[model samples]
Target: MEKTNVEKLYEWLNEAVMTINMHEDAPYLDNLAMAINVLFYHDTQNLNNDIVKKKLQTALENIQLEQYDKMEKSKAVQLAILTGMKQSTQQQHMMTPETVSLLTGYLASKLMAGHEKIRIFDPVSGTGSLLCTVIDQLQNPVEAYASEVDPTLIQLANGSANLLEKEIEFFHQDSLRPLLLDPVDLVVADLPVGYYPDDVTAAAYHLKSDEGHSYSHHLLIEQSINYVKEAGYLIFVIPNFLFDSDQADKLRGYLLEHAHIIGLLQLPETAFKSKNNAKSILILQKKSEKSKEPKQPLLVNLPSFKNARAMEDIMNQINTWFTGFKQN
Candidate 1:
């Protein structure tokens, strides 16, 4: 029987996942590249069975065999398994396709134009989704940087970048500290919520200490602001409760004192996988040459959302902004 394209795509994606799961030294980047490739070639039919095996076989063979030659299988396998299984540990932290689309859409809109060399950074980069999306969507080649406290996730992000032919400086470091690198023009980060660190005993780890005064999102945001230039833009996706809490006024005041609040996009409850319904986008800008001090504070409310439609609209809006910049 001739298999439909949908069936072939299903088979491909499944096989790719299965193969990576089995290979001891399979680079995490290769899996991302394979997944992305499958996403591009996917159809409704192949999402099920046939084409997957062929795709998996090809992806597996395409890995750099020499890279694995010096590596130890046990360690590699442990890392691979840890990463493959990370999403299954806590259902709450897993990101949905809608979230992925939103991240990519924002990047597409904001940084697509090659106007003046643009550098992008994500401090709490998870599995490199936002960083990769930004890299993949940019019209100009960007010097991309990302930091993930989780070593396994860091490996996955680095591996994905290698496979995609995307260059990014990814570090397994505490995002709370001063950035060891140069200032970025734009910063986009999905701040961490309640999630355990991969390492429990590391004293310097952010999640390790739930001190009386630290590990708060407000503090995290304050630290992140240090990484941006005086007039750079920061797009932060945060929990909804953050805007209504007692700390909200203080954080808002702090942000207003330091930066310009350009836009805010509130998200639907289902935008996150958690039962906690807190999702919102804060668009902040540092003092720029084109900036104006307004008499009144500005607030923008977003329209109701249907994931697919909203994502498309957001992407279009972003493209429009970039296109306008390109024209001017």
Candidate 2:
């Protein structure tokens, strides 16, 4: 069978990355980043293998990366990144699944309409998957910004954006720390779940625990809200236990004061390995006179992505809610 362009791109890149991996002592993810750069610039100055160089040049000639659309380019690189993740221990850097990112993108597209130009942010942009995916979904020109603390993940993310030719400004600092970014129109993140160890830094957040370490996810939500303009929306993939934890009251209090609940979609259990790790998509709008709570929130228990008929039904219902949302 003839290979699709995406498959071809992934296969060629994987071969080049493997060649680099054979010689480099660095991590596989880093090698994949270098391979992406080499593909981006068509520069093999660092790669001394004559045979692999010819093969890469041939792949570039046969496959026009420019001809591929943004989403296709993202998928190709995503395939490469998944290969790297399997060879490494950086499980925390996992990209949001394509299905979930598409779901978020659909919500963002509806939320961001009518704005000709807008700023968007992702506080924890893992490999730029969800951020870039959402950006591809928007019709307006976007000034995209993302931050990540991990060196490998950031490097891989930069390569992913570069290959897709989508310009995204990135910060390599810890997101919980003060960011220089101004308030943006929207914020999106696949919120990392765990306790933040920085007692001093966590102290500054309103969601900070009075006693022990603060939940990193809670602190992230607060920080992301701080960086969004008044009335702007925030979309988070939060764990199911987010509100059931011991610190739930304080977090709930912070939300009531700072934002309005927009929607919550409980994702299918099939998305996670265990029931305990299941997550839901939560939407919020920053508190402002202009952004009042919707009379009816869009609460849903999303069916498995594989269930086409049921998935379509949920989307139709969501569309109906969005129609009402606009009028509200």
Candidate 3:
């Protein structure tokens, strides 16, 4: 297939990003990439090396235009910017495309049954890809909310949302801290995984031990679960250790009591080669006041896929599982 003009623009932008000498200027690069995407979406023919360089040199104006279609070009722009940031700054703030698609497909299948409107949130929103993917996949009217600690990433997320003409309530704060908002219909995130020093908030959640060391991802899971309305869903991309590690036993017990584990998809080891972590997708429904003890969660181990064809097969199997779950 011949590459479109927008695709060529992305290639040019990516190459330009490599020539940047200062790491601190990566945020400026992010902003420039976003501007180029918006402009290209408006008029792909006008985009070229000279025009893009001119736009980046000048102050970018707000774009008021129709929403871009959900095509490769639209997705590639944000991805190219995110890739540039990662390469220059060595930051991890974006989810892989496969992870985004799997989560979005799961939500789309589950929500297809019946729902007029929904509220979705991502506590560790990163660049807002998870929330944006959900918005792109679902047919239901959705109010999206997200929080990220990085101000630059927040700007990029908000810019990407604007390019898509989607309204999102974004917070520039830590996700571990208490939020002053109503519980939402669903919470989805690819949580950051690591050890964190015990804080007052961790103490409040009872996740802090006398030893004063707590796993950050565990705390994020607990906090994200709190944001979910009763009977609502909490879906996360988490380390596979959450299922059986001795360190996570207490947290698992707490979840077994407070929420109904709906499903777990164990991803391939190569799923996040960038981070070198074995991860999985966990789906849970907040226990309703009158709901009975939770049933055993469905679990599926995905096959490793080295190419696009294999990935499509994996997605097909996932859709089958989702359909079965919805039926039962």
* Best candidate, lDDT: 2
Worst 10 residues of 2 by lDDT: 55-64
Collision pairs in model 3: none
lDDT of candidate 2 at residue 141, scale 0 to 100: 97
Sort the predicted structures by TM-score, highest score first: 2, 3, 1
Compared with the true structure, model 2 gives a TM-score of: 0.94
Write the residue-wise lDDT of candidate 1 on 1-328 in tens digits: 9964334433444456665445434444445334534433432233334455555546645443334321232123233334455645543224324444445455445643445567888888766656666565566657888987776567556654654456788878877665687878788777776433423332443223343333345656776667778777777777777777654666667776778775566665555556485577777777667654433322333444555676577657755654654344
lDDT of 2 by residue, 1-328 (tens): 9988888888878887777767667777888888888888877766676776766676667655677776667878998888888777755867788888989999999999999898999999979999988998999999999999998999899988998888999999999999999999999999998889999999999989889999999999999999999999999999998899999999999999999999999999898778987889999999998779899889999999999999999899999999999987
Each prediction's RMSD over C-alphas, in Å, is 9.5, 2.0, 5.2
The local lDDT score (0 to 100) that residue 154 gets in candidate 3 is 76
Ten consecutive residues with minimal summed lDDT in candidate 1?
69-78
> Sort by lDDT, best first: what order?
2, 3, 1
2 versus 3: better lDDT goes to: 2
The TM-scores of all predictions, comma-separated, are 0.65, 0.94, 0.79
